[model samples]
Target chain A: MDKRFWVLLGLFLLMTAAGLLLGEARFVFANASLICLSCIGIQ
Target chain B: MAFFARFTDALARLRRAPVQLTSTLLWNSYFLAPWLKNVPCPGFNCYSCPLAITACPIGTLQHFIIIRRVPLYLLGVLGLIGTLFGRTACGWTCPFGFLQDLLYKVPLPKWRVSNRWAPARYVIFALLVVIIPFIALEPWFCKLCPAGALEAGLPMIALQADLRELTGLLFAVKMVILALFLLWMMVTSRPFCRFVCPLGTIYGPFNRLSGMRLHFEESRCQHCDLCRHVCPTGLYPPEEIDTAGCIRCMECLKACPHGALQSCATGTSCTERSHA
Candidate 1:
């Protein structure tokens, strides 16, 4: 697979996991997590 | 007649700006986005957002779809934008597109899907406009919308007031989906624009034949591959542009140093550049 493909896959999984985990704590947790993933990791 | 012509010329120039100042001014001055009640047009604003000054077209449409009524006001807003610039609104005025542009600025591994993926947008369009509202009796598009998350969800939740009480499993679910999409966008070009944006779907078909479209000067052909390469959507200029897939982002305009590409109205001649 291409490098970006791997990076994207990895980021997707990481963000998804983080969202589910933090989402249980506070609804905002999911949004915060996503913004971070999109703004920091994927970006 | 001279005065009217001058006014038209000024309006044309304003519409052509890389960034539309009128949208910005309207947003702020008139509370263009109902969600950003505190700020004018605060960019990326959504109307369903508790504080918005203007209504969201998508939200309004969804509301109408669910209720089985036509939303004249919402349609008017979109029709007005369409009448003037067609999909130019996607490029210049949309807060969501602006937000996506900012996300694109981040240094990350980005991938562009094949043209095959373009059809998925139609599926999203269908679901948002047809299926979801019929089943849910509410605008499901707004629920999953990143615009809502940023414009409404975050602000209302942060404020800890009336809307805070509305937060629940559905809101949480929407937030999760939103994060995944945004993170994916960081890795990919535009997940929402490509796959799940109903607004894009609405404007997509119109863009193909819109008075505003990229006119190719077949004579100016160096065929340098720059236009093709620079196109974020990977559209082949030689073929009919898949307007649904094009956000009119103008990457090709800048990429074509040869001045071969120009945005013009349908059936316009190539002898001179003209805006429709």
Candidate 2:
């Protein structure tokens, strides 16, 4: 696999794990936040 | 031969009388101003745009974010269209992209952005998704959007009281930017898709993984620069075939007389259609 894929995979997995540990609503909100950040510039 | 067949299908759709007129009206009103009333389409057409027949999907998505509602109906609508068309919305349906397309028709000098600029989309994507929702209290994307200037700012300023009193500074700045971009487009073809547009940023990654894709048979390529020359997005097709920057506008396909490139859905290849 590409190096960038591993990096992205790591980040996604880390976020997902954190969300699962944190709970459902927060996880959804966090995922939404990631999506939002991805939508526009992250600054 | 296979390439010509796909181009023919696209051309046929373009010539379809009802589709042609409706798309033309949608494309024209997108920039010209004043829609008949409120309609909802799967892509961003500012609700505030005078001639808008649709509410922006991004705006509505933000609404769901704020209200904490699931946007069941809106998601259903967006999802249904997305499943069928993917980034076809960017090419065919999006008012903002259409505006950029029109601007690109102007005659002028232009430059192609570097791949270093590709990261800028992710930055825009982050800002639109994270900062706007968390910081700004309104439709954050709309506030600074030239699309909004064409869609909402012009008409709302005319029709509404408080909006009328507002100074033209912000709107003027946006217009100047739009004019500059249009000039750039005349020269460059698609500077906005290449360097700007957050929605394009969003839909772009999806295009790579979408059922719809640009397929390349590297063997057919004679190292000729024709496809690269015709590409408005200025993507290096040989080096990076599936970059997220591709808008799938198909100009390269049209420009290629060699039948090298094609728009394909899934595993379907022009060379193997009979087997399928």
Where model 2 places Cα greater than 4 Å from the true spot, the runs are: A1-43, B1-24, B27-40, B159-162, B168-180, B239-242, B271-276
TM-score of each model, paired residue for residue: 0.70, 0.69
Query: Which candidate has the top score in lDDT?
Result: 1
* Candidate 1 TM-score for chain A: 0.51
Kindly report which residue stretches of model 1 are placed more than 4 angstroms away from their true locations once superposed.
A1-43, B1-45, B161-166, B240-242, B271-276
Cα lDDT tens digits for candidate 2, B97-120 = 665566666655565666677677
Please give the TM-score that candidate 1 achieves against the real structure.
0.70
Tens digits of per-residue lDDT, candidate 1, B157-257, equal 67656555656777777688778877876776656666766776766665654444456677776889886875655677645443567666566655666
